[model samples]
Target: MMGLPFFRTPEIETPAEIEAASLRSDRFRLQRQVDWQRLDSIVTALENGRPRRISDEDLLDLPVLYRKTASGLAVARETSLDAATLAYLEALVQRAWFQVYGPRMGFTGWLRRFVGGGWSAAVRAIWLDICIALAVMAAGTLVGWLLVSREPDWFYALVPGGMAGGRTPGAGAAALRESLGTKPGSDGLSIFAASLFSNNTGVAIMAFALGFAFGVPTLLLLLYNMALLGAMLWVFADAGLGWEFAAWLSVHGTTELGAIMLAGAAGLHVGRTMAFPGDRSILAAMQAAGVRAAQVMAGCTIMLIVAGVLEGYVRQLVGDAAARAAIGTGMLLFWLGYFILSRPPRERET
Candidate 1:
């Protein structure tokens, strides 16, 4: 009996005391109702399709009002307010909370920002890397073309088996010429484009994935890729189809090779960041580098997709070599304008 604890009954409020508590809650709400109404009006206007009517000052004050409303709600809960008043405050705070802390823009907004400037800005930031990638690819192509042209037999080593799907060294001049001609219909082009995309995507992804290996693999892959181009050029040149082949390749090469170069640049950016890291730790450098590289890589993927369509579909439908060259030149110029001239908004984007 000494060890056992006694339990006490809960305090029951008198009817008068309950009425007094409700009165106090009413008074509390009346004191705060003006500010709550102001917040409610703004929130309602925003929610009911009049967002533009809300002034900048109102927008700035919104969060402050939200906090005040929330505080009032807490007080209402603790003070035993009437059910109607508590529900009103609860709804006010709940709806206003979205305006205070919500996704300001959606997917379409993001797409607009990215297409307008974010991507080009990302590419421009890594101009040095792009230049280096371009230089390396150019050198590799030169080396491949020179070696194959001089030795002739070096074409086998420069281009792996079945890599040259169309104009290989073994192809006769007549066959090489025929490869550049347009088919009768647009039907085959889509399939060819799909195949081209699949093949190039593999190379692009491999180039990007290898960036973690300190960039040597990326460099080598780019070198090998350009070597194949150079070898192909030589094969066509040997067949007296150099102009036709250049036109054919250039039709898609403007965007296709450009995408590959951008991808290589992104990879090199990652590799260089990992290798050097400057004053920062490798992990910190990589974190920043990854974001920058990813931004560029996103644009690269898009370019590759466009290139695939041009190569597979448009080129197949267009018969004239002159027109193909013009199209190629136009695309190259378009990219130049897109990345270099299209300035980003001066205001910070979310």
Candidate 2:
């Protein structure tokens, strides 16, 4: 009563049909019945948009089970069975077929999608938060710059000497100027730049990882990190090589600091979701915001690598203040243009 009735014959079964049906039914029920049932449930739920209820193990087994169901379906077609059994196998095969060979985005495809538009869309969505983060960093920089400029001793208090790499406020001008150029006999350029890059990466990681706690820690982190930058610059400038130091720093600062700022923005995004999760539950809002934040953070990480390489190779080769400024400024403008001005509009109308 349950299959292609137009092709079906009378209900009476021959002895051969009965024997074959018995063997096939027994084989399918024992070997594949449970998997088919599970597959049916998964396919049903997926079609309904409630896949979250599916367990990870079941999700993992979906394709495998789907393939197995297909094999069983092939077997079913070769064997005699009741109309009801044939109909059930046919339905299961169709569902499994959709899943096994359905449209899907593979890894390379996904990477292309992310690069093409995902990164830009994420950046645009959190532009306001990025502005706020930059403002905070600027405020902290100004405060630290002013503090060190007023009382040179504040540099020592604000920035660790180890991080200063002997570029203290009181260090001799000759000694300080030496830092403007690559060290005379140093193979430490790449190592040093990589170390600094790692340090910056750590700060960004901490800023993002700690953002779920209402973003207070993230705020403090941004303030402190930017303060260090300002204090370092002030110290170098006090030695009468402000422009030189600016040039040297700019070779990497635009990308490095920009990366940190984006991390701060990601942190703030999480914190805001925690504080004001509009209509959705806090967990739901956080989940959505986290995806956007991750996209921004990924781009930030790439920027940091670019910055580190420049610091190691490009900055090392160039020591003139003007040349350094030109390179650094050009890099900064490139980033601003790429992130803010270069991307195409989201959608086009024919």
Clashes of 2: 0
Residue 280 of candidate 2: its Cα lDDT?
100
TM-score of 1: 0.75
Model 1 CA lDDT for position 154: 85
Candidate 1 lDDT:
0.81
Clashes of each: 0, 0
Once superposed on the true structure, which residue ranges of model 1 sit more than 4 Å away at CA?
1-40, 55-57, 68-98, 146-166, 185-194, 280-284, 348-350
- lDDT comparing candidate 2 with the true structure: 0.79
lDDT of 2 by residue, 145-221 (tens): 99888998888888765567777778888877766667657542344345567778898999888888888898888
| Residue ranges of candidate 2 with Cα displaced over 4 Å | 1-22, 25-103, 187-195, 342-350
TM-scores of the models, in the given order?
0.75, 0.71
